[model samples]
Target: MVEKWLVALQVILAAIGVYQFTLSLFGIYRKKKHKEYEPKKTFAVLVAAHNEEAVIDALMENLKTVDYPKDMYDVFVICDNCTDNTADIVREHGWTACERHNPHQRGKGFAIEWMLKKLWEMPRQFDAVVMLDADNLVSPDFLREMNNDLCSGARVIQGYIDTKNPHDSWITAAYGVTYWYCNRLWQLSRTNLKMANFLGGTGMCFENQLLKDMGWGATSLVEDLEFTVRCVKNGVNPVFNYKARVYDEKPLTFKASARQRLRWMQGHFTVARRYFFPLLWQSLKERNLAKFDTALYTITVYTVLVTFLLTGYMWVDAALFNGPNFPTLYEYLPTWLAVVSVVATCAAFILALILEGVKSWRVYASLITFPIFLLSWWPITFYAFFTQNNKVWSHTEHTRVVRLDEVHGKQVS
Candidate 1:
């Protein structure tokens, strides 16, 4: 009986690993065949910066180079309680700057809310509001592509955010590869399949009315995830635009990376607790079974991580403790097959990394150091699981000047 149960568990885990791997492969294929569309609308680009004096100037320069109508697109920077020259830098760029002094209501969510409220009261307006992080440098045609998607009736659109400084260190390189893989395979492919895609913190465009109706309530540390969930609950599916690219920096140090990821994990946990049940209820009430399944998967990160670990343990135990006298816990053949399935799943991850390297020359150098980048995540993941008290926002350190030419093969501007 115990042997039968072990076999069943191993088989189930193997199947899941195979399924995830297959999805990733299919995702990469779909990304290659993605098409681009242009929108006939304008955009209001809103940036929320907190002590980003170093990077704000470059961001403004990149914003100015965007391939959209100058009359149709305008930049708005909300310097959220910055004790730096961020506001002055924005003013120097001849852009609109809103200085917000909110000590209690910290985090990007609050910064976004304050900006949205201020924008809502303005007489002059845009068709859609594009939200970007202060550190991001968007591609020239970003606005054009997002506007195109919006014109095609997409209420929300998420753009591809690539890393700008992957060569900074091994940790950054690993993060860069992961980001590329997620965006190119997971997000773009899922979007093509008509599946829900979460809004990344930056490079997302929203219909003005949707923003107004949603009230821009920023509460979670991972505001983007919460916002995406909220939109889905209200019957809005975010569209993914592969042509819209925004390059941003990754944490250079392991400590910074861990801090950033902990915040994300914590925010995800918070969202799972607060919105999961309500969203599930809303899905059932609206008869949207598909949406419900997506929501469940979004909140199942912890489960997925736990299952992966359990699968590894079972494989090792089966290999070491197999004998006729002892009598194995699971069917030996299925257990071996399960081990093979796990290996195949790892192959899929490597394939995704190689494909990303092929897509961009800048990432190729970092790919050699990918293993080091991955191993560093284990400690961070372990810490996140135990440190349930990580609610306070830990800001990532971003230096003002970037080695753009060395990393991207050309100056950003």
Candidate 2:
């Protein structure tokens, strides 16, 4: 009887996997009809920085070359509780430095809220606001692409996030591989399907009115995800712009990377618990597919944990007790079907690399060992589950600095 129940659970989990698999297929059709538009929107480009003296200058220099009207857009650096000369660097670059000295409320989310309130009080009005990290390098066409999206009626947009230092180290390359894979398979696919795209911490843009409507009150560790769920519940879907690209600096060491991912998981678990039921209820009330999809995404973070626990129980029952041998999902399903799933996964990974224009051999080799990185998340999810309420922010130090031209290996016009 226990074995039968276990088999049923596995079948249900496998069905969800199939749903995701079908969604990934849509990613392959990457072509979208993007309309060319004049730059009529004014932008307030906001960069959140904390003790980022090493890389802030490079980002400022990169922003100077953005292919948009200079008077139409302004850059503001939120120097959040910085002991270093982060604010000084921004002022040196002739951008506004909004120095936030609140040690109690110290996170990217808080800093952004503070800055947004200040921007609202100021005389200058903006059509949209773009959020970025201090270590990110934007493509020259980023603002132009964002302008196009705004002109075409997209209120919230997430730009493509690429790695700035993929070949810097094995750890960095693995991080690059994960982002590259997710950017295409997840973000692009959801865009093609007309599903909501979540706001990545950086490379996110929001219409000023939308931000004011939502109040920008997501002060969690993963404020981006929290705000995304809020947007979905309010019937606003965030769209993705593949042409608007921002290169972020990845952590160079495994220790740094683990700390970063652990914080992300902790925040993810928090958002799931807080909004999962509300989103489900909203979806049912409205009979909206987009809301249903967003609800599934909010709760799907735990599917891995549930799957791991079930598999472990099956193994222990088979080994210790006089029970049926641990039955694989494949045992209940067809052998050919399992083989096809494996083949499809490999093809998807290879397809991501090819479509993302990943030229670094080191990044490719590091991705070959990417399973170890995925496995590492199992322990993180377990730890984060227990400590979801611990909202203490863990800052991942970014020292790797690369210019916009260096990332593409050519002069970026």
Candidate 3:
């Protein structure tokens, strides 16, 4: 009976994995044919930077390249308690810069709220606000496309953010491939199907009114995800715009990646606990089927972690107790098939990297080591379970002076 149960569970898990894979492939297909939209109104580009002086120059240069009327659109950088020259760099570009020295409210959420309140107080304002990280570079037409989405009645628009340092190391390469696959396939398919998409940290646009009402009260680790969920529950479906591209630097070291991902995992777990019950109950009461889907996706983070643990336990049980005499169902299947599935997943990742036009052969070779990268997250996920030290806002250091020519052999300008 135990063997039968294990077999059933394994089969179900495998089927779900395959289904998600297929959905991702369909998303990639849809993304290829996505149309570009032009902006019909002015936008305010808000950047929250803390000690980002090294990269602020490139970011400012890219900001100037945005295809919009300079007099109409303005750039606002909120230097959140920075002891560095981040504020000075923004001011040097003749752009609007606000320096906040609040030691108590230190998170990005607080910085954004402070900026929004400041914008609201101004006599002249923008129709929409575009949020970006200090290390991010917007494409020349980013504002045009995002503005079009705003005119089309989309209160929230998410743009594609690709990594700029894929060739820095094996760790960065793996992250590049993962991000490329997700943006090109997973997000595209879900958006086409009218499903919800969580807001990425940057490359997102919001209506001025919405931000005014919400006040960025979600001062958590994954504030972007938390805020996105709040907007979805409030009847705002974020629209994904593949045409509006933003390039960001990836974490070049394992230590940096682990810290960043752990914070994300912890934040996700926190959100799951806080909103799952309330959202689930509200969805059922209102008979909102889409809300149900959002709730399921939000809850799946913890479920996937649990499933990984349970699967490992079953494998160990089969290996130790049911080896020869019991002949467990999983043991009957050819080991080569499991190996082949993993290889196929890697092949898909390689294909995605190639499709994104990555040129480094060494980076491509690092694709074989991708499994190691995936396994590195296990420790972080496990640690997140027992960790209640959510007070300290762990910030990832971004070194921006390194140009794309130095990393990838091509300069944007």
Candidate 4:
């Protein structure tokens, strides 16, 4: 029984691995000739800040010089239960600032919903709305790229996240590589295949109507992800605009990374519970591959669970259950699939680093140890399973602010 079940598990793991690898490969070779579109849409850029005074000044400075028309967008900042000068700085700097004092209501989603409510009551109407974190600096062309997509009839969009402090530590280096890998492996790749891309909590844009229609109430820890799936269910597909970039801070310490990733893993499970079955049903009922793609995307963590369990089973089988006639686990793993699983993923990461033009020797040098960082997720996954039911939002501390010109030593478009 154990032997037979092990075979079944191996097949499932291989299938899931191949699916991800195939999508990544398609994303790598897939390129499109983008048609030029006018940047005519007006936007309200929303920033949710929680005691982010350390980095607020830098983001404000970056926003002031964004390469779009001055009147095309207005920056709105929300100081959610802030005990610091975050609200004061925004107000002092000649920008709109809203103070959120409700201790009962926390997290970015609730804060954003409150801000949207305030905006809905205002006299001005916006064509689109963009959400950002206070620890981020926008590329000069951030609004322009989003405007291009909005004009092209995209209702929701996500921008690329470039790490502002990649060389801060090895932890940060791993975080940077992961983002670069994901930009191509997931979002850019999904965009290439004409599928909806997931949203990074920061640097996401939605049509004002959609925002109002849903009341900006995706209050889960993974609000960006929850909202992305909600958009798909509502028949709205999000487009990825790689040219629109936002530089965000990464946690420089292992403890900080663990805290942040735990929140993410927990929130992912929260979202999967509510939407996974619906997505699967839609895919079967409508014969929609895209819906199925999103469904698979939601449950990919199961692959990790299976991977860990299979390793334990193989260990025991080899030691005690080996009948001498029993085949090794490696023999069961398909040769081509096994080779592609390891080779393709690493190759994709290398290609991403090259494409992103990261020149720091430290960033490249850390690639050798990046596997250790990736393996950290396995333990984090189990940690989340124990703590997922706890509903508390623990924000990662983000004081690091290495500006674009400082990191790359040149102007970035």
Give me the overall lDDT of model 3: 0.77
Compare candidates 1 and 3 on lDDT and give the better one. Answer: 3
- Give candidates' CA RMSD values in order: 4.1, 2.3, 3.4, 2.5
Query: For residues 1-413, could you state the per-residue lDDT of candidate 3 as single tens digits?
Result: 86577667667666666766666665645545544455467788899898889888888877887778787689999899999998888989988889999988787888888888898899987888999998888778788888777877888889987777777778887887788777866677778778777688899999888877766777788788888778878988788888888788888899898998888888878888888887788889988865765676666566567666765676677799773443334486898978887777767777666666667676667768888888776667778877835745677889945543354452121
- Which should have the higher TM-score, number 2 or number 3? 2
lDDT (tens digit, per residue) of candidate 1 on 138-255: 8888988887777678999999878787666777767777887787667866775776787889999999988888877756888898888888887888888887888888888877
Q: TM-score for each prediction?
A: 0.85, 0.95, 0.87, 0.93
The number of the candidate with the highest TM-score is 2
**Candidate 4 versus the native: TM-score?**
0.93
Query: How much RMSD separates candidate 3 from the native structure?
Result: 3.4
Residue pairs in collision within model 2: none
Candidate 2: residue 145 lDDT (0-100): 95
In candidate 3, position 41 carries an lDDT of 77
- Comparing candidate 1 with candidate 2, which one achieves the higher TM-score? 2
Whole-model Cα lDDT per candidate? 0.75, 0.87, 0.77, 0.83
- The candidate with the higher TM-score, 3 or 4, is 4
